[model samples]
Target: MKTKKVVVGALAAMLSLSVCSLAPAVAAGETVQISVGKVNAKAGETFSVDVSLADIPSTGIQCLDFAVTYDSKVLTIDKVEAGALVKNGADSKDASASLAPLFEGSVNSSEGWVSAAWSTSTDDASYWLKSDGVFCTITGKVASGVADGTVSDLKIVPINRETYSKSGVTNKEISCGYEKDGKPVKYATTLNNGSVTVGTIVTTTTQPPTNKIVRGDANCDGGVDMSDVVLIMQSLANPNKYGLDGSDSKHITAQGQANGDVDSDVKGITSNDALKIQKWLLKSISEL
Candidate 1:
């Protein structure tokens, strides 16, 4: 019994040491904030949102897989591009480092989310620098029909660890490690999301007069009858002499001329317009 107990204690200590050696050391108090730029745009105009990271460690980060979701009803993503922070390095020496940044995601305008994965090659991850600038820029166009004062929230989400990497694929693990003790380091990060608000929409409208005018009332006598037809005929026969009022005392105003155009096709007035009004009055036609 003593021999068996001694062997069991020795194996437990060996296992403990193995875990310690394999586990990656964590850096304390590291933060990575995601912020978006606010903008005002007219309907059908395009704008850009900068997705930036603040307070990045100067040493650098190795790999990252993150996604941003947004309200598709208020905005639509046009394109996404890498920023200087992750594209280059802190110094000239690190500029030429093996930095290969790649992204894979789908922009769902209908579903209101963008699922993306960003990563660097293993070799590039080792030398990539960490800086306090934008990580990427997301250019989007405001939805043309979105009402004014609408708010769209943009969120950042990092994937979980269980499915992060192919656990059995030999040295595959999801990590955004920092440089530490001559090796890559791992740690927890704090993330912050952002949002944008829609501004007022400008529109042009033609308002009606205080008193509405009846269509086909050429003489402006408040009704479409034979007098209107007579006035229209007179106007068409001699626009200069008769002038939309026949030779009567009451002259057809501009509104009367417009109302006289019963066809409403904006084709201007003629004998046909007068004939149509006559047909409408006679019940030969339902309306002009």
Candidate 2:
């Protein structure tokens, strides 16, 4: 009887432990995402790509080192500047004793690379990098003699261990993350690469009466007509079909895209812009 009682007690204890193990443990969520915006340029023209981040964890970023590579043959690196997020101190607080941020980056045309690193002197819990916003801007010029419709990649360099690396590619190791309770926390992130394209001049059947292109001429054919309206509608309705993605050389030219602003607002091209263009063509309004 004594032995049976001891066995029952042990079984009960094991059952309790098993039930506890079934409960899920909570983990800190951290994400670093790199996004690129509107990568198109004409030959001999200076253009820029916006790099942004989202879902930044509160552990904040202790240190970050990354690099971007472009084709030197077609493009030349000009310079890199701190984005609004960093300049506004979006990541760190203004409290006294908070670590000051240090930013460093450069454009190396010779190496076809733009490398940047950022960090804070204090790794205390009081500091946190901004959660979301433009991280930096990469400005460059399309090199002369590059053929129209040429496309090139904007790849992230494997500068450190924490930096996202291509599969099967080896690179130097570096650590970056925020501190929690005096302990270092690793960050997980998703990286989105980008590409730049030198656009080709598109010729259309209908030309504007004047030599100058008019506003709302989304096709760059020198005129804003029903065709332009159709084009804009198609682009908005199904961007994939028209190669509206900047990665494709045949994508809508930057000028054409800009001219789509019939609303005369810098907000960006939207369905409303298309509607406004239609209204203008119908003589509903004198100006866009």
lDDT top scorer: 2
The parts of candidate 1 lying over 4 Å away from their true place are 1-24, 89-106, 115-117, 122-126, 159-175, 179-184, 200-288
Per-prediction backbone clash count: 0, 5
Question: How big is the positional error of residue 231 in model 1, measured in Å on the Cα after superposition?
Answer: 73
Worst 10 residues of 2 by lDDT: 1-10
Local accuracy of candidate 2 as per-residue lDDT tens digits, 1-288: 011122212222222212223421222465566655445567888776666666666545655556778889999878877765556453454332243335556677776878765555454544445556566777788888787889888887544221122223233322345444533454555666777778743433232234454688887877788777766544533343332553334445556666775653323344456678888889998887
Every model's TM-score = 0.48, 0.54
Off by over 4 Å in 2: 1-29, 90-101, 123-127, 160-175, 200-288
Clashing pairs in 2: 91-128, 91-129, 91-130, 161-173, 161-174
Q: List the residue pairs that clash in candidate 1.
A: none
Clashes of 2: 5
* Per-residue accuracy of model 1 over 84-183 as CA lDDT, tens digit each: 4555632333322233224334466665665433433335443464555556666677788776777787777542222212222222222355434455
